[model samples]
Target: MNTTPSMTLERQRADAASARRPEPKPATGSFQTVEPRLEIAPAGATGGELVDRYGEILTPAALEFLAALHDRFAGTRHELLAERLQTRVDAANGRDPRFMPETAWIRDDASWRVAGPGPGLEDRRVEITGPTDRKMAINALNSGAKVWLADQEDATSPTWANVVEGQLTLFDFLRGDLGYTSPEGKQYRVTAEETPTIVMRPRGWHLVEKHLTFHDRAGRAMHASGSLVDFGLYFFHNAKALIGSGRGPYFYLPKLESHREAKLWNDIFVFAQDALGIPQGTIRATVLIETIQAAFQMDEILYELREHCAGLNAGRWDYIFSIVKTFRSRGRRWVFPDRKAITMTVPFMRAYTELLVQTCHKRGAHAIGGMSAFIPNRRDPEVTERALAAVTADKRREAGDGFDGTWVAHPDLIPTARAEFDAVLGDRPNQVDRLRDDVEVAASDLLDIPSIGGEVTEAGVRDNVSIAIRYLESWLRGVGAAAIDNLMEDAATAEISRSQIWQWLDNNTVTAEGTRIDQTSIVRLMAEAVAALPRFEGDRFDDAISVFRTVALEPEFPTFLTVGAYARFL
Candidate 1:
């Protein structure tokens, strides 16, 4: 369990790397930008006294905490995001991303490892992921799982009410007050004996918390980073309570594209802990190597956060989305055939996970597998059996490949996922000592796009179109995670679905049935896809179709469909 002799040196190096980027003096600045716009109102409420509804938690001190984070880090965040555009441009011009030679020292230093998992994060074999709404939060807590990923990012829509109330839900959950009553008079409660450990996931770095604005001394008003707002408020309110209960504020950091971003988070953690008078490593984070850029620097990313790092998660959906977005402009070789064909077993994806497991175990970190898409159908026995069998095979492969744990969406898939891990990891909290040294992955292995076998089919196109429109409709209606065709579709689903359509049409792809994919065909399919949905008085199908066309049928590809749609709708 011992790591390297120097966690401080990495911080010093990060500090030096970010020295050129200007940060504010301290966490003491007043972020009063036009009288505190971070207040929330329930959906459909025109006007009422809304301050007292959430005034208990969004106090002066919490707002100050958020301002301090923006003052010190938001400028640097802008620079990093701007750098992404240039990277994509370079990638489009026949430049494949390679491992950073500058950070080889971090990767070469095998003695350095991420900090061991904090309390309640040791055995994460069956972690259920869902939104932080009151009812869903209660269900996830009592779902008989080891960890509940209280996701405020991908699984949640960034509505004014949803964002603020999610924090209230967390505040309530830790104090044994996360209870709910259904319209049918059904009660939901969490018992100490039955509840799972909570590991919250905030929004990604690319998102902005529009409600919280900060006006600088230069007289420019900018929105606060969603990452900062979510992490800052949660840490300010609950770090001490979680620490008091013997479990630290554990987190699943999503959508990090570089080690520099990891370094920024490390600095944020250091500052927040220091501000709160907590210990240096009291906070623990597990980075998701979801981006293709992050996949190439997994070692450096872990090293950057080694002092407060727990492990790494294989975020399969976003990773694939990143691939499509990264290589999207590069011609026919990079065009993905079908969304369903690109499973974890594909050569490139297998390379990504294999390298992740080897890198994490070599440095004494947990290598967690991605989520399983095996949502059980309650009414059909045959469908339930198929779901279980598929989940069993998926988890078995992960366990066999040296994954310490795996993720399942539904509670019904837990026994199947846990049994596979139990078969491999009996009596041990994890398999960190199982060194996968035989896995020698090259840059070419991770970029093996042509190795996957499958052709574009008409069913795949129709499904993508249908899912994109339907998912966006739900998202625009403030529902981020929706189950369509027995799969939990989140923002990542929309990104991949739209990105694939863009890539196929851009490359003039033909389906296996000899049908050409073009803007005309896509427009026709969009009408069919939208027409299939039920008509209601307040349906957002029109907006959803517009969003789909803007992102999928446009001349230039958009990085994330959620970004533009969020601006116009949420």
Candidate 2:
């Protein structure tokens, strides 16, 4: 692998900063012993601005624990990220992906099972998904779902305030003191039946949380992994309390490409447990198999994290995004139709879902299904009704296919999802007893992309452009999840939207309407889309347009659109 000149310069600057920084002083609390040369940067990618509220979570002990985690695992994380690039290179060179020969024994063995769901995780029939902003957090806690996926990954834009305030939200909610007072002087509080088990989904391994910098004694400094910062801060402050409440520190691990990445998380779990005096297996994790490479190694990923693993999640959006991304440079056969045409019942997607259910059931883990983007609209009854029907049908298929639970983007769809699972799993925690013996998904079944049988259309092209521009606009303004056309658009959706355009342009794909999707078509459609969107004060559409072109129109596609966008404009 070769390093770009810009990347090399960035590394040199980080190393220089580490050489000049003094060692951090140890202080009081449980994390006093674990100190490194870690310090908070003056500002973040959103630029040099830190609010007074950030001080609540940036105490000495929390910084120490986060530093210790980086000191131990940052090196391995760097290596694994390099390995991800190698995997891509190998695939591009016609090294067809198959089940890993090295970890075949784990797949063949039948006796091994992941640790069962920890307390409060036994029945996850319906989980609400949203960002950890105060309003969203309050809604999810009382949404009547079994679990709340407090997402910081795809659904969150990592502004420094978002990063630190999310940790504080978790800490305060668990202790029953979380509240919000609006500018109009109204008070809101967390009120509910057993507050849905909070499973925080940190950012993936590829991202660097620029707000926190790790300076090691080895005279090296860099932005810390977003994954470790979210995990470390939450675990440091709230692990014991969660355990005392019989609900351990649960997590939803996202964007794992192989078993090696899973193993890295397993090692972190063991170390964090030891560091905090929590029992082994006290932390339960549900891995989201959203990437194409990860699909081929589902069994091995579970095996690596078996000691602390809970289950796997199928993502209709991100999985499709991964497919387009992994094979982006291939021929027209690998190209997909409009985003609307790539439904869940498509051949490749069905095979992925069936294999996920079968593999998880075989290993005695939950088979959680994908999330649908059709969020309900309270202002319009017709839209809400349409969303209910779509959610019901999707959740019904998942439950019938033997999924234990499913993800809903809005609270209004919770009853519809739970009803589907309730019908299939009456009086039972899960359907893991059914091993899905009838499911036989070969490597070809998972990779049968040409069998997707759909035509690319001009409307599809315009839709993709619209979604990309609108979603990126929201992201640039410090928002990760945006509602567009009754659908919740997040980073995953933006990736698929842009990657599809990049794919179509690369393959010289001709739409059914006899239109070639080139730069001219994109620019025209982008202007119309931007005009259609209602503008507000301080909107970042101009910057969003720049990001869209950089990620979608460039000859060379960046790995993840968020990385480049974060670098240039928050």
Candidate 3:
């Protein structure tokens, strides 16, 4: 079937947006940072001037490409976001998600396989993840892991400087010319031979690039999809060069709730490949089955993206966040214990990971495991040893459970994770052949949240309050991921921390110390936690406390705190 004229025009716009190389001189001046400029200022799209230094990135063609993506797919994205609410309502009202019956054929057929792993992605036993700052980017790439996840979603605070400078960093990284020197005189440079392969994880679909706006047919100003802006700029600039160098443009798709969302991504991949005149399967992506709804549809998700699919990941943090968000209103039966108590070994989490391994191997894809978010505490050798042991044990279990690989937040943990997987994998690139036929999981198993019952203690409550405020303060200061209390904390950590409080308050639960989580106690704890926190020199410290209180004490749960917080700050 032929597409409508509008879609055709959209395709043309995207195709025309690919930047042609003619070596435009770098913008010169003492650059004053500003909002990105609009070259093709459509009726509803306008913005502040782009800094002269970033002009090469925000060229007329690049903005048009992002505009095209907004015009063509933004409507469907809105409908999908709306549908998530209905899905949650149905789930709460006894329509719990199971394997879809209609897609049985897709699962039963055994011959279909995803395109094999691209050049540098063959053995992904250890991958390090971090934000795209100049120093961190160099450190992560130089980390011994096989892949470095240049993260824009959880690891990045999407300030205007972060958004624009991140694009510039990736462009420079890919060109083998990126370098940075700290004020203390530590120099960093890319290790061409030893650098891990790059896999960019864009902001999730739920986020919008507030710095750039696109107009719709009705002349309404709409925030361009964060995913599009990140993916478009990277692909537009680096696709051909990466392909020529034997590594193609790779991605880690985050926060998908359903197979339909995966289908939308597959369509986007198809359009992106065609528009750029690349091979259909050139762009490979691994879907992070992070949502509760997505856990039930792993098979369908891989099937939808088979041509462009790499694998599925156990996005543990957001998976927990999804569980809380989906069943927040279902009362005490679904009330979870402390965040630390919900380990991967729990029956429900075990079932989810087992199902993921089985589904991925059955369909010829890698099964990646959860993040071991243990940041080493260098000040205390005993602390570092314990964290290392725990990380080692976690990777050991994942490798034994048939996972092809796992993730680490710090470079120090890479050797530990790699050692465990190395013992299992040996010389093999991946264990995709380990089809887990013995495992069987059901809907009740996935929804079994209360099975691992532990006491919610005063310490846990204080920890939640403490982590939320500190993480948010760091986030507002333009750092997304931080090491607090010897643990790596990100946006997902803050979300779970706050939402768990809201759930406990909503259910009127008492802590192990006999403290009720009413609004009064919550406010008191917030004040105490803020006081206990080290004084950071900024008004945003207070802002973090206020935001944390509103989200934790409000009657209605906020879908995502970052969405509102972004509007206020970024």
Candidate 4:
């Protein structure tokens, strides 16, 4: 939180530039910048010359919009994040999560509907998600899906280079000129006559962008919110362009815990549109009901962002991780079985998804389902077939249960997912009209994990350690989503994997093989995992081991391992 003397001087210089700059004529579209006082300087931690191409996306107008967003909403974001910590503490001390008594009116009111889907978001049967690297961007856009969730959050490592490059990549994609020639001399581009609609997922509210530091009114150097930076840059530069193309700035909001957080996003959207001179509801966002508390507040969340809301998504990995984090202190009563056992078929998960579909359709919003994290392996035909079949079954279940759409991490799995949805949807764009009046889920149903039982296995423990370490190493090496043993492993998955180990240790969990897991056993497993992974030339794997040790074995569990682990990048 402290700023060095040099950073202070840099902040002063930037402040002076803002003070001296004069108001400028607006840009040539409905959205424009009235004043151009923004000057961005690197925060000195990850200093490297940005590519000249980055200038195309990080224009003065874009930075000014970001500055305005930070000025208006960063304080509220800070307060909300603090509120999250307190809320978690309260939940730990027996403050049960239930539908808010005060928000019952909003939930009961069935007359209102979220502003209907914008142009490109109408029929999102299948959405491919990935970090916005150039090749992946081209592949995802070209994938035969209706939408691509261009991710900058969990799917991406927040390296300075990755952040800026992602912006530039998206900028190029919007212009319809984004393409990549692989090192093997193969070319990739958006070959489809109608490429997938893009929905960008910015970093969650908890993460910060250390590379872009701003000063508060008290003259303290503060890291910019990653959410603001990602949303600001994309919207500032591309809102009008996307609007012209009949597609607007669509987003996927992640890890929100309450309606208040959704309200914050709504306020930010309103402010951003107003500042840029765009229409009031030009932005559309789908909130990921990934947290347990968020699952309870679906209707209220939709109401908060109704004007700009697209729908709600059921996120698998993060939803499981949230369960562990929120109820870790509640003893074996909240203890989970093996991560593999808690599938979509489980009672609690089914309750959550059924309630989500009912709530979204009841409010005339699309209910998207969780990701199918199966990546096909080229060498193993058998494995690929099995994975595709599993993906098919999952999508079939979602479609049958009235989900409008779902997510796939790899392009190869898109067709399998799309086919399942097609069988249900046929000619319909979405099942928002499927009110799902037959479903009724209670608070107890959502918290019924204890009843669905299985034992922790040594294989489960070793798999958790192996996957976490591998994913963390890749993350530290500037790759957020890594394909380890055919599954797409992201920060959310890693969080679950590592946190389960922590929980198992905290509760003195006995594996099915009658072996008790303790700190020493976990350390031995960690060493074995490290030995199994192929050694690279650098210290990234070592650093990942230490980070895993801290998060998995430390006395107190950190809310998000990425928060502390990211500092190692700096």
Candidate 5:
């Protein structure tokens, strides 16, 4: 990391300013200085302007340090840069803070409850009608799921109408409408019976209490939970109501990006509990470690919410995007494309699973794996069996790898999946015991390269960097065409030589509707670009590319893709 002459001078000035100030403080009126400050300029800025801006906010020393850092980063491979940045951000956030010294969270002999004797599969059952629809609601309830996500997110069509309807349905289900039955030769009917043990995934942070268009029995307009409302509020408001009515539906928290974010959620849950007059641990929170940053700090995150957090679950589609975006620079090397090939059996995944299990066991929590998004075709037995087999295999692997349970997309796959998990997990030691031995390692050590096994390869690094750059470049160019190879090229490569053309287009980036570049459009455009890449020459390449594209285009695509894209560029 070499500092340019100008940067060096800037650093000196920043150092002097810092020394004079003694204590760091946020800039405020009157106290604000005209002196240069260190700032992260948006990526498209020219070197001269960037330097000039650096002089304005940063003290001499700060400027020099930043410049030196910038020099070190300049022209470096994307993967290396990404790794360094990831490391830097981790350190800054105190992500690996040491709360205790050399005390393993999981003891070798410690044990916890396993969800099943073998592999256990939980399917997500979504209800669209309002809670008042006991017949339909109970049907979903009786469908047999280890977990049923009462979606307030994408599953519902029109936001306003669905929210109130969904909430009411939940209320009824908890109260008494959940009784259902079907005779041997009869169609399934709601018989007012209730079944215990179904987990709920509430709507996202979109809609909570606004009035919507659900009609009452008389068919007149009535107020209900709207689509565009905050899900947290909805859960907070209804959790007690449902529990008071004698139904316990645990929650699955979604879209979390970091441990800090998880902590924030814990805080929110606490606030909700207090406001609702519920006990602190009454509402169990499961944090979705879906982002790249979150994946790296799983242990700390789990620790942060030890008391309130119920468990952790991997979000496969989101996690994949997180990986791609987090390490996009290395996408060209086929690491990301060949992720399935890498096998969840790899040491890195093992480390993650191990940490997850360790963290959960330490806190007496459940460690759950995410869903296998396999949609079975009931008409086609082969397709159904294949789907079931894939899910069963995943559950077996997860249970063997120490996950207590896993999720499935369809109800039909649940029985088999659960059976598989139950078979493997029968009377095994809990994950807590395993993690107890490793808890003695410092937080930093837990996240260090040694704990994760080998250093990230150059090819891996490059792929991440390339993917990120190409995605961004394609986004800027209104054409929505991301070149996979562009990320692999250095300044000396032909691809790099042609960078200006794309940069210019990106600079003038606009939407098909001729609107300014918004984040949503940028994401959609990036996916299109990535998808438009020339298919590579291999059987796996076709499938990999298709999977990548399909996952990118899914409704939840935005949550993961944006994070993935940002991880690379940042």
Candidate 6:
């Protein structure tokens, strides 16, 4: 402890010399090797502190591993790690079916009240007939569609005259003077006015190859940039530029099948937004759910780009074709009728509707029903009234069944459909109450019994049978049909009742042997059922029962019954 300064200096010099000298090599048979040690700070410690602490705990071998980990997690590199983790999180959450339920909880709460008024028919459909008629186009726009699809997809001619004229006319509508004709053989003139209702559906993706032309104002041909040759690119660029000028049309996204396809569109939208200096959410999109796969995975597709999606539409004809094509390979194994003869009451249609309603409601979206293809016969008052009446009835039924709105093919049908929806849903209680109750009942543990065989007694079965038979009888006779509580009957009881009825038919238990078990008989039976139920009221339920009975009594019913009977026989 009491060393002289010269002795201390000599000791330090000896230590420095020792540090500079090379370390001794290990012997071939040596057993002593240094092991690495690592130190980890508490979870919340800062990077610098953690690094210092880690250095303190690390042996030579551990220092290398710590340096690698630190380098991987540092600065811009950390964002890459975060992205990888986020991707894993997305995959995990996306795979969970329960994720939708949790995500939809807020929507479920908000949709509890019946949907309020939305952008009406005046906000959804537009018609364009002539190829280059700007006046006609402007007049059509007067119909007031929120977004108009100037359809080069289906409505335009394939000739160059038509195509160029159409393009020029569209330009004129946006930039040049437009002239109008009055009823009294007078002409009215107006200049170009910016309108939001003029989206163009360029010839489809497959047909773009046929429409490539590169020419300037001098009518001289110019070399086409391979990128500009694509119709999608051209349309995208021009539309984006027009949008920058505050005159662009929102896109009606077509032919999307997968979430990847949606993301592709989202990418394009993002590009357009950045290039045009437009706000990200300013451009709206309505995805056409036409393909079978699109229908099933629509929720995922929408959720992927929910910020960009305006809404979705039920593309009926394409959907019908999709269904037939999708199931055609299954051959006779499928029980459904030929596609042409199938009605909306079929199970397929029911499933589609259910899925559509659920998806739209879960996203706080407007559930617009399919179009009525009926046209009015205005010459005959009776025919017109009947058509209007039929449309009103159909729309009312759809609205009552929980659709927010519907589409009509003709301009005249729009007002009627709107009126029907307004009449049905404007003042009524929301349908969400029933959905909430059902969800609650389904989730309750008390209702989780495995089987009803021991619990359902003979007396209980007999009472249900008796009630069902009486209800069926009243329904068939069409007596007091408006008073049946059809929803209160369980599926088991309905099956038993139908079984008993068939048994009676088979055993010749009824007195009228010659009376065929036809549609009429089925209708009467359902009417009887409605009459027997005490809790039900209103003609609305009766109407529903009538429709259901009609469906049940179709010729297909017998075919279904025969199949079931034969299967049981085997």
**What TM-score does candidate 2 get on C-alpha atoms?**
0.93
- What would the TM-score be for candidate 1 when compared with the true structure? 0.92
Q: How close is every model to the real structure, measured as TM-score? A: 0.92, 0.93, 0.91, 0.92, 0.51, 0.46
List, residue by residue over 199-237, the lDDT tens digit for candidate 5: 455443212222212222222222222211333334543
lDDT score, candidate 5: 0.42
| Deviation from native of the Cα of residue 366 in model 5, angstroms | 0.6
Candidate 1 C-alpha lDDT tens digits along 466-519: 998999999888888898887878998778898899888878899999999888
Clash pairs detected, candidate 1? none
Candidate 2 Cα deviation (angstroms), residue 145: 0.3
Off by over 4 Å in 5: 1-139, 154-158, 178-198, 202-233, 245-249, 330-335, 338-343, 427-570
Give the per-residue lDDT of model 4 (tens digit) for 1-570.
Answer: 111223333443443343331122234655533332334555465553456687776776677777778767777786677667666666776787898899999988879999868989999999999999999888887788899999999999988788989998988877878888889999887788888888999999988887666654434456678899999998888889899888999999999999999999999999988888998988999999999989989999999999999999999789999999888767778878888888999999999999999999988888998887777898999889989998999999999999999999988898899899999999999988988899989999999988778889999999999999999999998999999988889999999999999889888888999998898999999899888777868748889999998898886677899989986664
Q: List where candidate 4 sits over 4 angstroms from the true fold.
A: 1-45
- Candidate 6 has its poorest 10 consecutive residues by lDDT at 440-449
| Candidate 1 local Cα displacement, residue 63, angstroms | 0.5
Q: In candidate 2, residue 353 scores what lDDT?
A: 96
TM-score of 5: 0.51
Show where candidate 6 strays beyond 4 Å. Answer: 1-139, 144-149, 154-169, 175-207, 213-248, 333-340, 379-386, 424-570
In model 2, state the lDDT of residue 146.
94
Model 3 TM-score is: 0.91
Predictions in order: lDDT: 0.84, 0.86, 0.83, 0.85, 0.42, 0.41
Cα lDDT of model 3 by residue, 172-242, tens digit: 87777899999999999987468887889998888987777766544456677889888988888889988
